[model samples]
Target: MKKSPRRTFIRDTAIAATGFFIVPRHTLGRGFVAPSDKLNIAGIGVGGKAEVNLPFAWNNGSDNIAALCDVDDRMAVKARARWPKAPYYKDYRVLLEKEQKNIDAVIITTPDHMHAVQALAAMQLGKHVYLEKPLTHDIYEARTLTKAAEKYRVVTQMGNQGSSGDDTRLVETWIQSGVIGEVKKVHVWTNRPTWPQGVPVPKGSFNVPAELDWDLWLGTAPQRDYNPAFLPAIWRGWSDYGTGSLGDMGCHFIDVPYRALKLGYPVSVECNVGSVYTGFFQEAIYYESYPPSSITYIQFPARGEMPPVEMIWYDGGMKPPRPAELQPEEQMGELDGGIIFEGSTGKLMAGLFGRKPTLLPLSKMASATLPKSAFEFVENGSDGHQQQWVKACKKGYGAYTSSSFDKSG
Candidate 1:
């Protein structure tokens, strides 16, 4: 007789569930779930996005949050109040080392620069990971993480929730239907830099706050003074800690045209940025921070029967030319940003998160009947984004996921 691998895995995993609460089968109602069935999850950067991300994992009813790690205690206060029982740590390395036995997976919502190291370490330990967007700060890191997912054979997903949305699929269908003809160009714009950017590095330093671990927050970044300018989300605008506006929103908007047109790695990229002047006489380059505004153009080769495509990105209140099809009263994109695909025949557009995709020339949209939905909507829609990864973890690796690190990273 051969041993059942499922039973073997459960028997072995029982050793790791030392302190987990196991709901008894009889009291579990019709669907009696065993303790071993749920994934014991840990969270890194358990604030900001984790405010919603962590709760989404728990909402799936098949995940148990075992621990949380954050560099600043003040920022983590809200998360701690919600998941009071989960053990807390100030550093991710220590959390991974000490709690390795207790966790089955990890959710990394940390800053851009710190993402690669923390995620790579978790993968090395055989834990699944759900990383936030712009998977890495560098192209090298992105390639490394993508390859590591296959090497480690772990379930991996990026935090580009739009990948799980039906709107993304709808855009694909419209393009394939030839309604928009061949998409030769795309314009993606955002109004980010709502935070500070294009400024000189702050010379003044402040004493580290009692609740913050300045050293830990610096992570892989070079050592620097404890400046508030780099903390509490302002880091996104800095060169050392963040990837600028392009890095901030690229993954989200690019995912649309990239997936819709079946685009691949860009062949060439060109960009221009606005100058940051600090004084009446001196124009500050502020290499330390991202520009106040910038525009980048990326060219992708043709795929299969599709023609070569040119994609443009705008940030810091800059935008592409409005389409002639757009009415005088109609808005181009929302205040935050939007994605516009230009085909020989017409254009299709969507707002942030790829919601509410519509064809230009409102009349065309009203008269044309949509083709049968060629793509199946993710169950539970966008909220299912987190749960999809959670289910894949429980279902074992190789389970299909929309934004697997191999694709997004």
Candidate 2:
């Protein structure tokens, strides 16, 4: 009888586990769970979103949580309490070196600036990586990581759960199958910067908190005295530490349209940021941070059979003009954000994550030519995205993932 690779590998792990070489539960504690099929995983940046992301990726203990690392002990409290047996460290470099033998994959939920460095470091050691969206802090780093993922021949996934959803694939089918003929323009908008921006860094005598490692938390970013202004979740508004609102939610917002249209690199891009007035004629010195609002235009060159495409991004509560085809009572998009693709025959609108996709005019759905999909495109939500990566990791390198560097980059 032929054995599937997954089952064969699990059998081997079970054999290895039952060997004379055994581990003491006392060392790893009662939390030590040795599931033969489980991948030994590490959690980097186990705070903020990582707090939530870890569970989704861990998938309720389907995978073993072997190690945990974070710069802030205060922020790490909940995670540490949850996985006490998983050794904790304040420094990723240290955790990588010490736990290198224990973990098979690394989940990176660090801030934008640290993403490239942490992910690159882990991948260099041949560990599979699950990194958050936007991929890296800059274009160069993003390109570098993309090449590294291929060169190292390791399984990788980007944390854009919307890409894994059924709505995303459905949108892809609708566009690819010509339901919306030749999209030439797209408008994406978000209501981000829910954190403060457009203001200069605050002034005060701030003390670095005892539970946090200020220097490590600011990895690759320029050094400054740690301040309360950037703590917990406010870093998204800062230019040095975070990617601002665009990087905060743009990846999720653009994933559907970009993939469906095959919109490659932009030919030309331009952007303008709104200014903040500091009373009188003076404007706030916010060059160090993104503005409260921004509008960007990206023009992509035509692909083989596709036409040149123009995509506009609006954030900070800005939105495009309401389509005339729709009645006044019809909703344009969710309060969070939405996207509209202007095609030759009609327009397609969807929520930020491609949810509730619809044809314009409310009446168009009646006559819209729905495409026949080869397979059902019904995947959606973050839980499925995390499990997708976990299962892919178990399947080894070259396994499929929805938003690997190839797609997300």
Candidate 3:
């Protein structure tokens, strides 16, 4: 593949960021050059979550944000302002083509459906990719992207930030130390309370914003009338653009237990969905949308060194029944999200989103001693997810959260 001019810029940025000694240009072997030098990065879908991660990418040592792309010009404006020197575009393809040589890696924070297409295109051109999670909208896309990453030999990282969290490491340690004993089942929940669940689609015709490119936003999804409800953040509840609440947070909430147990693809997945009918329909009343909630049951068969386990995911105002041993007062302070492990020896409860979990049945938890062999915490402080990607790209190091084609598929 003919490398683009952007490759030079990317190499320089990587070098500067890492303060690595640049190899003399005269010594460059036939085609090989040090991976680190400088890195030229591009941001896709510069709205919503993209806004949060874009700044981090820069902070992590991206020399220059070469391009900014988003369907909604309004959304891109903020990012453009932040990186005044970078060129901007409404379509990602145009950005990619124009900045082909000026860009080395692309950060995809687009809607779920567009992730695979845009990412695959970038990888085809040999650009490293840092994609937001669930990895892809559907299982197949996940599989395809994984294959592309391997084929291209491009550095890749999923947006599961928690995978790099200290709390997550703590959870892993606790499990490995036998603090939770043999886990047979786990329940995870998040307060995905958005619009009235179970409510019917709203009936209305509203003018689409001029700055918003509706068709591009729809992308591969079936076309539908413009609805403000789906825009911004509430789209997660809808089946089309977003992946219900489960897809939204599964990667984050379930990631800890998944890693601790070395979970693989689930054997079967069955959803106990709320009363939301199929077909293209918008919710009319907030309360009339989907039935205020649903629970998805995922069953995973035994993997190496791990036994089969049942995982229950709860969201949209639904919660698992409280353990009988806990007093009513003890449950009062519990937040809307968390995980509970039902082990053969005892039960353990953790705070929402993988906080260092505490043993349940307060009394027994206090008396129990954990095993000695466990990962010790070292203070490398700060959320280093973005930094990890930057270092990996510069050094050609493989990522810890790299999803496999088979597992994600």
In TM-score terms, which candidate is top?
A: 1
Question: What's the distance in Å from true for residue 146, model 1?
Answer: 0.6
Give the alpha carbon lDDT tens digit for every residue of 262-327 in model 3: 787788998886555455683333442334577989999887656799999988778888888688
Top model number, lDDT: 1
lDDT of each: 0.82, 0.80, 0.70
A best-first ranking of the candidates according to their TM-score comes to 1, 2, 3
- lDDT, candidate 1, 64-94, per-residue tens: 8889999899878998887789999987867
Query: What's the lDDT of the predicted structure labeled candidate 2?
Result: 0.80
Per-prediction TM-score to the true structure, in the order listed: 0.90, 0.88, 0.82
TM-score winner, 2 or 3: 2
lDDT of 2 by residue, 77-111 (tens): 88999999999988786777778767778899888
When 1 and 3 are scored with TM-score, the better candidate is 1
Which run of 10 residues does model 3 get worst, by summed lDDT?
17-26
> Per lDDT, what order, best first?
1, 2, 3
